[model samples]
Target: MFTSRMFAAGAAGFALAAMGPAGTAHALHSDTFAADNAESAAVVSAQIADTGSLDGDCTGTAIAPHWVLTARHCIEPFPTPGGSVRLGQGDQQRRVQVDHWEAAPAGDIALLHTVEDMGLASYPTVSDTVPGLGAARLYGWSPDGSGKTTKLPVAEGEITELLDMSLFEGKQMINVDTHNGGKTQPGDSGGPLFVDGKVVGTLSASLGDDKDGMSDVAAYAVVAEQYDWVMETISGGGQGADAGTPGRGDLNAAWLVGGGGGVLVAIGASVVVLRGRGKSDAG
Candidate 1:
């Protein structure tokens, strides 16, 4: 199964231990997000914290006015379906009470449900299939080598091949290159990758934690393969909706931590560290 390490092993000190990209950690690389892009429909950014300090965690997107999509491992140490999603920035910013959080039974993809509308712009999934060999653009809110933040930074590269790593068994993964410094770093977990004008993948993991935040390689879960589960979850046709929210309690009480809201509770990083490569059966 796609585990937490698959999403943030670099940041949490797992794969490529010394060579991670999350701030001398693991995989967020490239430049700062353009200021104009923040106003683009539904592209949201978030930072995770706790009662003690700001952990500066993952990033995600609004799939619906009440639903957010991110890497399953991003919610480390915290129980899903209970944390709050701090969406947007500046005057347009707001928070979505994540009442429902469910990881796909298999892949690194996960969904967050809000009790109320987030009123953000959501990216459309491509109607046609994503070509095997094509260029892709990575986006995220993680700070870069220059320590830039408050904007969405993007990196351009190609979706070279399908991943053949063990962690991705039975999972459709796209091996995106981090060549020339393009990458997904610390705090960039769960960010989206765009192809053409639609989202084709979700940021997963990278091979190093170099100071630039760009790793030797990066991996993403193909959005096309994950579309079915995403749709089912959004329409209430998925599993875990009625599972009831547990952990730190409801959003209201759980959010008030450290000083303000957004503190995550009990989310831990996974220990598995496996390499991803090309597969013979690119399905």
Candidate 2:
């Protein structure tokens, strides 16, 4: 209900030299295996929904029951006529229609508006431009060594530096190590990067495709930098556009920016309640 669509049409323009088309990232590494089902709750497969069945080339996170965050490039031919976000697992899964989407004017990020509640718990986010250097983890439902997508997997590595890309020139990205012991394969686009038990970035592209669509250098749309746009959209009243929701009341943006130690007072936004990963820093 956040306005018929509060954001402007078309994606933000960015630098071509920054894009380079080199560092596009993908799915999971061959070694990655099934992760806990709890981890898969908030993650969803962004697939073609016109058909009854769901299959995805990319993934997204449910920032709210009625909204999803993904890569703009994932839904090419912008303003996709039809698509759906399938969340949860098995017979208990929920598939919601993808009505409208607004792309981040400058970066590879895009926000998909769902016609129904996603039926999944929303993930909490941060407002930091950079997620202080340390260990960061990636989560996605990419194929494993045998090309099997049995379950979602979690990848761990040190967040080395803030990468710069032509596609997202003005944006700051969190770079994770992929060559040595971890990396992302094809179909992993739009995954989430966690730091301090909060979402800090959305998996974008990567550098150097090893013929199979895997890469060592991956770039993510930093969550902190894009936080304002997200809160604003939800604040515009994401209930039903006509639900008569106010614009910006108790978004708890301040508490989110202060990190997750205080009790949140949910207002018009999704109440984010995530169990800590048992680490003070990204693991």
Q: Across residues 149-178, which tens digit of lDDT does each residue of candidate 1 receive?
A: 344556677878876431223255577775
How far in Å is the alpha carbon of 234 misplaced in model 1?
0.6
lDDT of each: 0.48, 0.50
**Model 2 weakest lDDT span, ten residues long:** 1-10
Model 2 lDDT per residue over 1-283, tens place? 0000011112333212111112222334345543434345667766533421244445677766566776655553333435777676556666788877666656656677788866544344534457877787676544332223345666676788886532333366566664334555434566677776667777765533345434555566777666676666655533332132223334333322201111111223211111111112111
Per-residue lDDT, model 1, residue 91, is: 55
Best by TM-score: 2
